[model samples]
Target: MSLAEAPFVGNASARRVHGFAAGSTALLVGDPADGSHLAEAVAELGLVPQSVSGGSAGDVLARLAREAAALATSGAAVPLTVFAADLRVSAVALLDLVDRPSARTSVAIAGPHEIAKDPSAFTLIRVERTQRLVHSVGSARHVVSAPNALAVGALLVAPEDVPAAAQLWAAAADDPWVDPALDPFDLALVALVRGGVSVSSVPLGPYDVRRGAGVTVGAAGSPWQQRLYGASRGDDGFFSTFAVRPLSRRLTAFGLAHGWSPNVVTVTSLGLGVLAALLTATESRAAWVAAAVLLLSALVVDCVDGEIARFSRRFSALGAWLDAVGDRVKEYALLAAVAWVSVRRGEPAWLLATTAMALTTMRHLEDGAYMDRTATSRSHLVPDRLDLGPARDLGPADAPTSLPGAVSRRASAVSWAKRVAHMPIAERYLVLALGLLTGSTQVVLWAITLTVAGALVWSQGGRTVKALLGSDGYERDARRVDGRWSDLDHETDLGPLARGAGRIAPLPFTASVVGVGMVAVCAWFIDTGRLPRVAVVLAVLAALVVGAGCRPSIEHRLGWQVPAALWGAESLLVLGVAATLPGGGQWCAYAYLAAVAWHRYDVLYRLRDTGSPSASWVTAVTLGVDGRWVLLAFLVATGASMQSALAWAAVLLTLVYGAESAAHWRAWLGREGALRSEVARREAEV
Candidate 1:
């Protein structure tokens, strides 16, 4: 029988209380005679329970292989949480430990006494430090003698490793000394270790509830639920933790009880943020106070969406993208509104607002690029340099300094202080709200600029130095970065002539940077009307033509920085061009920048998730970077009608990029939902 049709004996209400999403699978492995209780426990934890009878080692291996294949074919991307029927553990504990799906393999670990109860059934593995590297797996007594011994009571097979697990088991079936009942867990542990998979250990001591005979959950008020809440409160800004979470967590719990999805909470938060921005533009004491309150309220709701996702293990890629983009939209909208109010009061605040927006965007681009590069290039088993202690050396004579020992303590205030240095969304939002409330637009704008500038220099500057001096393979990392940033498909956008010319004289990285720099300078001169229109048109055209053909071929070790440099240049060009216009023209420039920013961030998210950027047509319509520069030249040439030209450009860019991007992502989401539904349907059938 399929696991879904298996006999379940646990209290039916228990199934409703377990908050995991539908379609999870759990396997009960033990003698056929005693598997009923295990199946009952799995059912109680809201998973489809299947039983695998103990037999000869070869037979067990065959059965496991078949089950793994079935799960794989059924589109079960979530890992299979396998439990030993002999294990006397609380179902609540097991569910709490393994409900959150992860790519890494995790095993439920028990104390020596618990292992002693089923010594032959357990596989003891040695784990060192928090990294949880399993070096050896064997008989319980032999392996448990080592320090940090984790006795495996359960096994988790990540979907990607499902086939490997099946093959490893089939291969081990012929081992002469393999005990089917005792060594299946050992063989699985060995497979994970040999495959270089990091093993996470979920210790069961705190959650264990074997009081004499009957299983029981933790003390009154469900400690597991409390732990879930705590885990969901992840490391946010210090202000968020101290000021926002206490209320947000309660609201999250209320939402969870009422069956609210993360996406719903996200929409609510977005509305509040937008409303707050609109109110901020009213330019009055009452409106400012109301805006500040609403902004903070919006942040609280924002925290709820993420917390709900974590608490219920209902994460979605679309939800993540929306949350990230939502924050950017809210912050930018607030800045623009403040700038508008300042302008209404007869002040030139667009410059400061533009600086803040451009600086923030540059920081985000650099951060994302650096993170993507490092993650893709990482292939080692050692701790990252930032995680190591001072005694750990990265390389001779030029090693970067590690976090101090005090910072390693999980509960230390120093650790919290260290996180605060990152200046996360919570901190940034608080700064913006406070500045808006105080009625000093320039002061708040400068505060944000200086703070972000300082944080960027502190973070990226150190990382650049470390990347250069570390013993890790910097060349490989640089190549990955280059591929990520320079993988843009500009041929279609550049037209046939430009594409053909690119073959003969493609711009090198250094020349492209210089060319973009020249364009920015000339654009500024043109916008301010400091140069004759004919001279401006000629110089801009010359600068644009330098990169009008192809993308930069970056081969330098520091080519990753080239994108940020180009982005900075683009900001200068846009701001300078916008400055030439009068009243509403500035908002049009901001709108154009916003559209471009959305596309840029969309590219980053898509590249990170799918390993590809938006489609070629999208780039063509938006006018790829080279096309944009050429277009700017034309706009400069229309010196008398600059305002009308700029307005049309902004409107066209927004409509084309925004509409196409929304349509693209909507189609993607629809496909994803359909796949998920198919998987769930298959699970139900099984």
Candidate 2:
């Protein structure tokens, strides 16, 4: 007889010959070939195999228990044999079954048989204890019911077991299931049953398989599987992604060595900024140099603080908060220094200082309020518990106490507007240079000191106010109520408004031509003693104001508002020089001519904000745009103007401004071309 048609008599005959019970159950465990033989022996002894298949270890154990339960409920005899592919399957299912006392237990070994010169052998063996309790007439019927009943009954089981049972039924009911279509779990289940072993427990732990004679079973740990698991953790080194430079590294190291926390660095920078302001108040040239150095040092230290935090992994919410407070202090100090200089020089000081303070404060307040509102709105929309503070703050030390504090911290941490105002290198240097040039060094130094004092007050004042009010009082104050400035307006853009003033931008071609012509005509007329000085001043101011108003959009985009204000200042300065002219029309004529040339140059070269331009470029352009022509005109008109070294200093500024402007133009053009090329490439690809 062929192996398939051979009587399944090996384990079955042993049980029968030994007078064991036909329904006794036994668990089968051995090599696949040996297990097949045991299965055939069990079948020969008149027992049946029940099988279940699944993908995961958890799923497999669940399926095995479900199949075992089904078999027991089907009225199978007390002794049943369970065949498992590996120890892992058997262990998992055995533990599960032990937990559920209702599951029936059995063991059997199904081993391969050789017949008709082929290895398509199957064996089933029954336990030798219970065969006499069975009747011969009903044995065939029990065997026939095994496959069909298990398949149909599995459908009535719990939803979780349905998928595994369905897989088993599919394989048994069709030949295609045994082909390449069969998964590893399905194949193992089918092979166990065919080897005459009754499957009870699912495969759980590692399985070892030998592919050739004298070959050892492969180890349990698979490299590919381990990698897949490890990759899920998602860790990447910092340098690979951030590309931090050596200078940043050195700065970070320095800060760490000095025991300087980011917050401390931020505070120290503010202090230095105050020193720069004080320098501006001095008439001495040495004071200006000192102020410049201090400001530059502050900028460097400011950069180092952040780098240190990132490098040392010591970032904190409090540090960030202090940093922001320090930034405001520095800004106010610089501006105040300028005002002090103006005041000492007999200019209107209080008005300028107050205006600067109010504008800066309001802008920051608006920015903070807007961010808080936006975050609150988003939180309401998304149902997630988002902690928007520093990564460290989310831990036990700062577990959120109240909804408002949590929201406030998050809002403060992520407000982009606050960061934008102070971080750029160009901005810090600009403030430094402006402070040095506009006022005496002592004025600058005093401004810096005052700024630091103000910052300390603002920062500490809020907490003091909150403490006096108590928690309930603070909460009441924190409550939001509708007010003005909440509404968005089209004119909210800051850049273009600043640039519309000629002081922040290059003069338009028409303006340049007209300015040149008017200066020439005024100079010639003054030489003849026929020019009107007041008319010249009024006419020039009117032209500048009108010109500035015409290109509001461009000014807004470029952040030229300050430059525009400076233009108004220039006109006033020119008027002052003209009024002081000794020869009346003759000498005053030079002042008018100089004003036109200087204004034109200012419009063309004054540093305009190009949305985060490089520090080098900003500095270069700023220094290049000189007002020497205007100063020369002032000297010629006043007649009594000093020829001291200090007078020559003004002339030097003109040359610097010119050089900076030329360099900036070159860089801007290159950047523009690169951007255009990138756009073209993207379009082509599309």
> On residues 1-686, what C-alpha lDDT tens digit does candidate 2 reach at each position?
11232222112111112112234333332233333443453344333444433343234434444454555566643333344332222111121122121232222121121111211112111211111100000011112111100110000112233333344433333332233322223233333333233333211112122211211222223421221121111121222112223333445444555566667778888888888777766646678778777876676566666655543334343455455556656655665566555655655353334334443443333333233233333322211111111112112343332111123666655553333333233343544565575545344444433543353345334434544454212111122342211111111211222223444554542343354334444444333445345335433533343344333222111122223223333333333334443322222222232323332323222212232222333333332111322333344444444333223433543465445445655676687576546434433432
Number of the top-ranking candidate, with TM-score as the measure: 1
Q: Model 1 over residues 440-520: C-alpha lDDT tens digits?
A: 888778888887887777767877787667643444533334323343332113323333445566655456555655767
Return the top candidate by lDDT. 1
User: RMSD of each candidate?
Assistant: 7.8, 30.5
Question: What is the Cα-based TM-score of model 1?
Answer: 0.75
- Candidate 2 wrongly placed segments (more than 4 Å): 1-249, 383-429, 432-686
Q: On a 0 to 100 scale, what is the lDDT of residue 204 in model 1?
A: 53
Candidate 1 runs further than 4 Å off: 1-39, 45-80, 84-153, 158-163, 170-187, 195-220, 227-233, 379-415, 470-502, 527-556, 581-585, 609-612, 679-686
lDDT of 2: 0.35
- TM-score of each candidate structure, all chains considered together: 0.75, 0.28
The lDDT of each candidate is 0.61, 0.35
Residue 514 in model 1: shift from native, Å?
Answer: 2.8
Clash list (residue pairs), candidate 1? none
